[model samples]
Target: MINDDLTHTPSTDQTTPAVATPDDRRPLGSTGLLASPVTVGTSGLGTPASADGSPAAGSTAFATAALRGPNLLVDTSNAYSDGRSETAIGDAIRQGGLPEGRGVVTKADQDPSTAVFDRDRVLRSFEESLERLGVERIPVFHLHDPYSVSFEDASAPGGAIEGMLALKEQGLVDAIGIAAGAISVMLPYVRTGVFDVLLTHNRFTLVDRSATGLLEEARSRGMGVFNAAPFGGGLLAGRRGRDGKPATYAYQAGSPELLAWVDRADELATRHGIPLAAAALAFSTRSELVDSTVVGMNRPERLEQVEALRTTLIPDDFWSDLEALGTPPSTITD
Candidate 1:
């Protein structure tokens, strides 16, 4: 069952100071847009119960705090809770009186059930997102989950990519990007050189580096690389469900091997007196290839903790040990 309080609570506190200053903002490639090294992920801020169906009493508070910070980038989607995510963000921006420098990155090209990737559908989706976000323009708009549509269909005449380009031409969007779980599907779009950014999740975390090559390719092309889900879903965050098992990868149940990997990571974290989630966050953001690390937070406190983790100094030996435990060699620097 979905938690009632998580979906509709807008009265959460907003007194917390912004996490970072203007100097903390990082350039998002050559787009001339600057983003916080840590971007707030609002997928969970939408109305659906989180994977564990827990109440997210802190979502509004988190959003308000994040918007007030120096690096103001919130990643949301039209499909998230049927646009609740965008609405919530819009509401927060108004309530918090966030400045104009704050930027929003929303997505289009959802699956067929939610949206199609044709020119008309893409245009309609962007319009809806603009209304939901209460903004005349978006800094970054991505073609979300392109793996759901054939590459041929998406790149052909009257395709979604073409529609996005049109919006850029008209100044509706500052930059365009492709975000997806499947590297194979997103890489083709990156190679097109039409996109200014790329967002890859799950495949580039502490326990997984399958997207390392993809990151390298994006970097070589001077595309901004946004790394999402640095905690491997909720596993590296050390969140366990009522079932007593760790939250699975991408919200599904974990395989035995995956669970075992988490077990070892947890043990190592405990030995060092560090939160496993902190280690995971630090590991994901350490790479120079990553222009920004996006983490999903539904609570104000969790957002604060993440901000702390970004600048937290983990001992070098801890990183060496963590790397020894099986992070992909390709992703290791020094």
Candidate 2:
């Protein structure tokens, strides 16, 4: 369902012998960057310690391990944790050292205080990201969540889009991407034929296939497609919070009907004797439409957990049954 050059690993699906693994490195669209099927998201990366201005040792250790991988991609944003996400990740990479072919992808976000996504703000954002990330150049830089700025302003000459293109010209950014929600808003940007990547989150998961069209279009155009939040922010994995409460999708509550769908999927996984998270993960990795699946792994233990999930062999029938459940009614399906 993608370009001729974009190939996918064969799905295991009970009949296939190989279990789904993130070890396989594939080309990321035409960017010349080969990355792991799963990208480590730094949305949950903690801020630097106030006393010493250093990130937690755990985060650095995790980053070191991930960096050492053949070609894993690290996803971060300018606004995440008010810039500390980039700081922590950059610190980790600095301490661990960046390996060739391994990529770190960050986004240029609108000013949180001003809500300005104009050209000046966008350029400033990218500069800040570079400074925080402790890097001279970024492999991939995205315009993260441009909904605050109208389509006209974002696309106008010398606007946000131009700023990103300028970075590409200067060699500051190898590939420019558009990462946003709202299919309506994203589609128009997709037609511009300038972006080298597309990152969609919360909309392309086992429960919600809203980003299917976005993924398809990006793949067709030979642009890298990143499907984030495959676990719907831990709901599909049945993860609990530090408070021991059930995880919500995108940090909001889920509808009862949607919960029903999740319950059914969980039960089905139980019957199949496989982790529900595996099914959720496979939903992305098994698809040739997605070049990478971005998952938030705040701690080192997450590495082991993801490895286990990827190795779980799920049957095709389970996916069929889950699909039969259909999209749950009502929005905010957690």
Candidate 3:
């Protein structure tokens, strides 16, 4: 919910049919992962349905959009809002009458400090997520927080990775993936090629380019890559929008370099006559390294930010201008 737009509402009625094919059906990227170029993040879509607690307008807007065309990939986690996000997505799926074409991606969290791997923990976590989503099987299931755990343990005989693979084999999941805290954490798995997708941050994002190698690895292995946090937690989008504040409220005090980057981003937007969010979205999708850019929506109006994609696209020069204003890859000064 932190990065979501806040003016949307949720629906409680299940009578409405929420399935409609959009005119646009495109592959996510060269990676062969088919989906709408614009994927919806369900992080905060499940909050209170309405001010009266009937249904949230935000949820209805997303459901409507999903019904329109955008592959509608909803990402959630067992740990997000103590599992309310998933529960809310489930409620919205039922009440809004979402269709089967929309895919759900949910993560599994485990304590890294525990050297011992537990299959029961993995099963329980996935089962709870399925229950919250009110789905028989999640289209995509990921091994969340794949940090600190050894690859052997991660893919061991009875580890979480193995459990997920079992689920995939049993048809409980269409595909299995690894969502790490960083791209480096996903490298070993990428080499294994056992996973179909890799969801991680900081590799192709605003502040980092360290994961370029990982992207190539995934491509070589014929796996899909999703760039998370392309905005660098809103640092890349710069400040100010129709909302009148920075995209992220979580950052109260930022570095001097960060502020300067924000200023330059705004300048580039002004010069190119494009929105900062569009620039960021265009940047992420332009890269062969990224299959999809995950954008979170909490309000109905927030969808307007991305709705531009339906009609407008940023020019290549917008990216060139942004790169000129951002930190150099070789320089870690920021």
Please, what are the lDDT tens digits per residue for candidate 1 over residues 78-175?
87655667777776776765576778899985544754668777788899888877789889999888655688888899988888899999998889
User: How far out, in Å, is residue 260 in model 2?
Assistant: 1.3
Better of 2 and 3 by TM-score: 2
Q: Rank the candidates by TM-score, best first.
A: 2, 1, 3
Model 2 steric clash pairs: 249-334
- What C-alpha lDDT values do all the predictions have? 0.74, 0.74, 0.62
Candidate 3 lDDT tens digits, 1-334: 2243222455434344435454455564343446655566665655654455533444544555544334457677776655667766676667655566677788776743353445656787888898877889877777877554677787777877778778888988777788765455677777876788877663465555677777788777767667665555555555434354433322334545555666677677878887666666666766777776666665434455565643466777776766776573321211
lDDT preference between candidates 2 and 3, better one: 2
The alpha-carbon lDDT assigned to residue 112 of candidate 1 equals 48
Task: Please list the residue runs of candidate 3 whose C-alpha ends up more than 4 Å from where it truly belongs after superposition.
Answer: 1-20, 28-33, 45-69, 111-117, 240-253, 309-311, 326-334
Put down candidate 2 lDDT per residue, 88-151, tens digits, no spaces. 7687667656765677899988888989888889889988988887889999889888978888
Ten residues in a row with the worst lDDT in model 1?
1-10
In candidate 2, where is summed lDDT lowest over 10 consecutive residues? 1-10
What's the TM-score of each model vs. the native? 0.86, 0.87, 0.79
* Distance from true location, Cα of 304 in model 1, Å: 1.0
- Model 3: number of backbone collisions: 15
Candidate 1 vs candidate 3: the lDDT winner is 1
